[model samples]
Target chain A: MDAIDCDVHCAPDSYEALFPHLSEYWRQYITEAGIRVNGLAHAYPRGVGATAPSTYEALADRVLDRRGVRFVILNCLTGFETHRNAYFGAAVASAINDWVREEFLARDEGLRASLVVSTISPEDAVAEIERVGEDRRFVQVLLPVRSDLPWGHKNNHAVFAAARERGLQVALHAWGRAGKAPTPSGFTTTYLEDYVGNQSIAQGQVLSFVSEGVFERFPDLRVVLIECGFAWLPPLLWRFDKDWKGVWREVPWLGRRPSEYVREHFRATTAPAHLPRDPVLLDQLLEMLDGPGMLTYASDYPHEHGDGLAGLLDRLGEEQRRSVMWSTAAELYGLAGNPAASSRA
Target chain B: MSHVEVRSGGAPVTKRGVELVDCDVHAQATEPMLAQYLSAPARRLLERYGRRTPRVTEWYPRARNAGMRVDAWPGKPGHIWGSDPELMRAQLLDEFGIDYAVLEVLSGQDCYDHPDFAAEWNHAINQWQLEEWLSFDPRLRGTIAVPHEYPALAVAEIERRAGDERFVAVLLPASAAEQLGSPKYWPIYEAAAAYGRPVAFHTGGYVDHRGPGYPSYYLEYHVGNGIVMQSQLASMVAGGMFEAVPGLRVVLTECGVAWAAALQWSLDAAWELMRDDHPRLERRPSEYIREHVWFTTQPIEEPDDPKQLVWAIEQAGIGERLLFATDYPHWDFDSPKQALPRVMDASLRRAILCENALELYGLPRERAVP
Candidate 1:
């Protein structure tokens, strides 16, 4: 069976690496301003235990090659979120996309990437999508999980519209130096606080998308929530389903149950697979989430300490394993059958 | 302590020697009482502006009784369910056989945006609890409603109220401008810790910045309350508030139980990989939650399987952490006898209904049935 690794981060070492891809104006501005690379605070410091193995060769060999991944979607985590300035964000995103394309995807036949877009301006995001989205290797449009507004709000419709127009999935990955705390609440004192709080943001974004009628607005758009643990999803959806019954009129555009739309329009990548001590509870949780069809395999490559694909496969039933390991992602990313399929064969 | 007339239909205590303590019974004061406590400027502004509280929408629909039990209405044209002390006692404490009921007042003024108003309203409400409610009923324990945005003022209130053991906890709105874990709110935590008072975070009053955004209806707002609580819990755990104030205990009043289980698992998972991000955390995040946090059993998550509920409670370590709450006079009040599974252990039932809460609040146990 061909396996599709849905989430794998390919971070650039420095701005110098993307200097060729960046326009002269940005290069000069960055140099003159003495702006450090990525200009964003990393929750995990480099050379620390949490830092993923950095080299592209190491990622390919350790994750894709070792795991027998037929295809892998590269999600580049750079300081693109530092670009509150529209021009700067767009330039950083463009350079990162170009850097990933040339330095990684081109070299690996099995590699694919999410077209990174600076969402400071939907117009810029759409334009960037229009520019780089046509590339067949780019399977999705990557936006950081921390956005100014819920991604479902109409303000974000342009990015989703552009992605759907290009036959691309929109993936929300964890990165971006959030202007406020990752949660609705203001800043926390520590990085751990922000990290655990990411789940709330992911859950809120999903609720925002469903409640705001994002699916009804664009039926073709699919959202993949990456790095957010999936155990909390069942409860959130259950609550949304219960609440939507009474408030459906508020969002009259939503024609079905919130959970129904969730099952239809959303895909989740398994990285930090939060396994409860009781394995039975984990099984029941997945059953509640309708996991066979919703979960996708992801290593969060080089990020030290995620539930590896092998560990997850061991826990799931055969049917669930198949879906989580490859099929669900392949079907979602629209890679059911492609040239890469032959590599596994 | 003052004496009160005992009424029937008191919330029952199923286990013998377990005197029932309702974790979340509300007490409310009329508008005139609130006006008296306000500063001259606030009172003048209140009269002129007609009590401005930030709301996302003009209308918030509630079922008959305004999302209170259909029968809980005081029958007075002007009164909501918990506003009438007599009605609250008869409907919640007497009928349910509750030995004690902690009061959580929801006046819509708790989350007042202006620092002066929020502080004054909280002070007034806490005062109202003292004069009108606690003085009227010894069975009733009061909470100091602290204005979370102004930590200095909030800490001062906690300091003032610390002498009164009747005031068992400090109540902060579930929804706040800053999450409970943010260092900005730590002064309140510090005060509570110094005084050995648990911080009770009750749902509502946090409409300004809801986790998902403002809702169209009250049902969404009501169910979404737990989501807000979850975020606050994460903030507290991740923000290292527990580390900063080691003696502090957080009681999640209106938030449901199951999410804590999920958070425990998820936090532990995240910590395993990202422990370096928070070097101050001496132990796993879940360990901090287990030791420092207590969740109320109102809006208890009703999973399809009866066993799943127990499984979740046990999985979250809430068997020890869960506090039985009726959310009395509200729409979804859980009758203690029926709220939990029939198969629950007698010890566990007693712990949730009476013992755990008594221990956390440092209330002396009344081992004999009253």
Candidate 2:
């Protein structure tokens, strides 16, 4: 069985190219300052083996033509990530969504995209979803994980409503913002820390959404936390239920178990699976996590080393392996057209 | 049909063929038991500041459901610290198949009666942690809790307790009266370092003491996990706790994982800007976190994506630093099996369930059953 690295990510074209198609209002904000997550200082430098920022023709050529792979699900850098100026954050989010619809998805049938949105201003994010969600090609809604608060705050329901209206999954990515920054005793940080930080962000985001009854409101609104990893899954589900029982009076609507909601609505991707190659450890993780379907494989292409190789897909049972590769994501993003199996089987 | 049978061996056996090491199991302290080990001065402080005795009980009535009358919440049975030890043992170690349980006690009420009698009060708490908590059960492991006001005394307390085999680590409120893990609190870490014990920075009470800027409510405190998350994690990283004590290891307990990715990235950015400040450090702030820090995830209520958990580990590159913690007896305790999607594969479970924890705490997997 060949490995199908379904979560492989590649950026397409530069911001300048994507900017032209955005609305005049968005174009103004995007032009004034580059994209940036609110508090995160890191920048999305370039895609792996990138030439010309990231181009669709180049991305498709690399992804579809790979000698030994099933597909690469490209996670586009949120258009709003490059610009730190919060004033234009909303406009840039709209423009990024517009670029995906007009250029990448409109021109090619072989591509999938995570539509970027403005996390600061949920209204603009909702507007962006309304504008781009109509396209069948737009499979996911990508929002920066880097914000003063996790994206699940009740105030952000407008964005959730928009995505739910279009049957689109919310793609949570690692990005940072200002105000209420974690730890004021600023110090030098490292890449490894950034990786773990992403997971922490996802944990907070998932908790906020569940505690706020986000799933209860939009049962169909699946929140796929791509690139955050799966190590925390076991403890998170445990802690939420444990804490919820003690504080259930605070959140009246959390009737069902938190995991039940997660099983129904969330999907996570495994790129650069961090643990060492120990069969025993991996086995226990699967048992603890309960299954591989929730742990999809992503190449995170444009980086020096992609997610995994053909050897990995061959390691699991046929059914389990297929779900991680394509079926799970296909169902998640409501991609009725993709060539994935229909049934959970 | 297959039944899990331990065939006369000393290795853990399970249905999925996996063992677990819970890094953050908690223990409850009884006033009498903890008071026994306290000195005259410490004992008085506990009776005074810890309990704030001669007190009036105020009730904020709440309804369990709609149309119900509001009443003071006594909380669930065994809600704070279940009276039974065997029950805790089975739930934390046996049920989850965990081998080690890093026990953090239920911290007493705070902000009032602090600063003046601080060390004495903390000594009382630490005495209970070591005396009553250490022997709660075979699975229970304990840490020394200290009063943050007296950093030097807190350090001294840690040094005294570090030699005990039962004492696994030291606990500090990431937010007491002041932001924790800051340079101001380096003495606490220094004491931890002297004993080769790790610092378990647990989150609580920051909402009451600090300005979280959120409306008062249970959800606000619980949901705004970042109130402590921001100050503690950020303070540790930015304050160069890692730099101050290169050999020191920091632990984050019951704090959610959502802010970690951004916080770490922001720190790395800050690391560049504040190069002159932390001139003694060899690497970036995130580097110390990757190497020396560990976090516990329980009641993982947020984020539906199981892979994002892995992504987070990868992002932090602290897989070794991650420990599967169940804040048992408290609100967010989790069953190992119930924590993750039942479909997760075996290899991933092994790392999250046991190996990672064993490596993190440097513990031997007891040959209880195979």
Best by TM-score: 1
Please tell me what DockQ candidate 1 reaches: 0.37
**A-chain TM-score in candidate 2?**
0.82
Q: Highest lDDT: which candidate?
A: 1
RMSD of 1: 4.9
Chain A TM-score vs. truth, each candidate? 0.92, 0.82
- How far off is residue A261 in model 2, in Å? 1.5
Please write out the lDDT profile of model 1 over residues A96-164, one tens digit for every residue.
888888888788878888898887788989999999988878888887777766677787888888888
Residue A226's lDDT within candidate 1 is 89
Task: Provide per-model DockQ scores.
Answer: 0.37, 0.06
Evaluate residue B85 in candidate 2 and report its C-alpha lDDT on the 0 to 100 scale: 56
Interface RMSD for candidates 1 onward, in order:
3.1, 7.9
